[model samples]
Target: MVMKVLFAGTPEVALPSLELLAGDREHFEVVSVLTRPDAPSGRGRRLMPSPVKEAALRLGLPVLESDPSDPSFPDVVKATGARYAAVVAYGRILRQPVLDALEGGWYNLHFSLLPQWRGAAPVQRSIWSGDTVTGATVFRLTKGMDEGPILSQSTVEIGPDENAGQLLDRLAQDGSRLLAASLEAVGEGRARLVPQSPGAYEVARKITGEDAHIRFDVPAFAADRQIRACTPEPGAWCLLHAEGGRDDTGLVLHVLRARPLPADDRAAPRDLPAGRLARTKRQVWVGTKSNPLELLEVKPAGKKAMKAADWARGARLADDAWCG
Candidate 1:
């Protein structure tokens, strides 16, 4: 018996699960795809369809667009006669009525294990906090944000140097398989629900522009985590002064890739201030409280990303020049 499922998602991270559910016709049938309306994108500000919408249209599935907050959304979903709804990065909070409309309820493929990182921007928050391990969760959707009973989950180790974008790509692929297995169990009436322990989880809130600036007063490793978490999105940036010590007139350089230097490698002269810029023949290093960070890649404002060594050579930075 094939269970009809309504799919809701937007963005590239949700693509794998959407495709998986649509292709598994024997066990589940995608009744319709609901995504946000087209929005402006790129330098031209042209309206563009979401990745999920594009994928659904390519597969000949009906697509619906509307704000989930609209009171009539439950009716709209109920009209589809979908036995279940699967949501992955849908970017909206569903109301109680909407939750009740689907006969089998909604199953969400969250990027982090709930009740941890339950809000928006889970992948980014996990990396920002220097978590050693993170995973995906398939859970029953409720009124509260990510406060749902778990259907299934799969864990993955967080690589030391992994950034938010790289980690999300891996989790998206792994999550699709977990979602599929959970769906099968639900369909066969053999699925188990595990309630999350109260007061045992941390929240993963959205990232803001203020969070992207690198602070040199903190430990080098913390600064490294900030750089990786902010990369590929609101990039981590610092102001760089010329060798002549004109702090008032400096260039803002976005740090795209960086790593912390070991304790021995960070030993510097007592007079060297934090945010000081130093360079070896092949690499660019910046001072922090505990140690210095080696800049592997960087982008000057309004310029393309390039190797830090290349940028340093082009700028003709003096040995004593500093950045903050």
Candidate 2:
């Protein structure tokens, strides 16, 4: 029998799994999708539907909305007549009443491996920690934040310089396939949730704007990790300080791409003074406590994102100008 399933999620990343399961109608029936409602967006502040809602409409599936903690939410879940639920970045915690409404169980597709990075910002945290490997996990939904029984998992290698956004994009795709397989296995009576061992695991706390500030006073490698973790989200930003330029207190310099230069063993000290900006014809490098970091792409204040060299050429960077 095709499993009647309730799909719940809110963001663009959720679309892949929803589409995957929707296409496999013979095995899983997506009775309805539960997602956060539209929110005001853009300069006009017009209400815009979530990516999941947009995809659900385009796929001709029923859509539902509710706060999970609402007392009457159980009735809403029961109304769908769904035995199972699948969630991907649903953006809200599931209340126990909602979990009790499903017979097969609620399965969550998380970006990080189980017992590690178990929280809202797993993908971002894993990259920041210099983890060589990270993956996705499909686990049974429980009250604890991402503390659930493991159903299925798949591993992925983190590229040497891959930023959080780029890595998360790949994980979302890999995770969609893993989620589908886990649900299918359950339908085949092979669902076995390995109970997670009770222990202290790394918690992936949310990445905030304050956390995105890059500190060149630190080792180049450490600063590199901080910049990469914030890329394409809060974004690695700095205040520009130039001798000839106007007071740059309000000038924001966005560093889109950068890498730490390998320390030279022959040199007495790896690199020069920290925070100083230096440039060549084709590249811009920022000094750190150890080896300097190469700034690849940057968006200077009131400028479009471009190669770091291009920004340097236009700005005619002051000799003592530093990034803070």
Name the top lDDT candidate.
Answer: 2
Backbone clash pairs for candidate 1 read: none
Report every candidate's CA lDDT. 0.88, 0.88
TM-score of each: 0.94, 0.95
lDDT of 1 by residue, 68-125 (tens): 7898889999888798999999898888998999989899999997888988888888
TM-score of 1: 0.94
Off by over 4 Å in 1: 243-249, 266-272
lDDT of 2 at 98: 86
Position 159, candidate 1: lDDT: 93
Candidate 1 whole-model C-alpha lDDT, 0 to 1:
0.88
Clashes of each: 0, 0
**TM-score of structure candidate 2:** 0.95
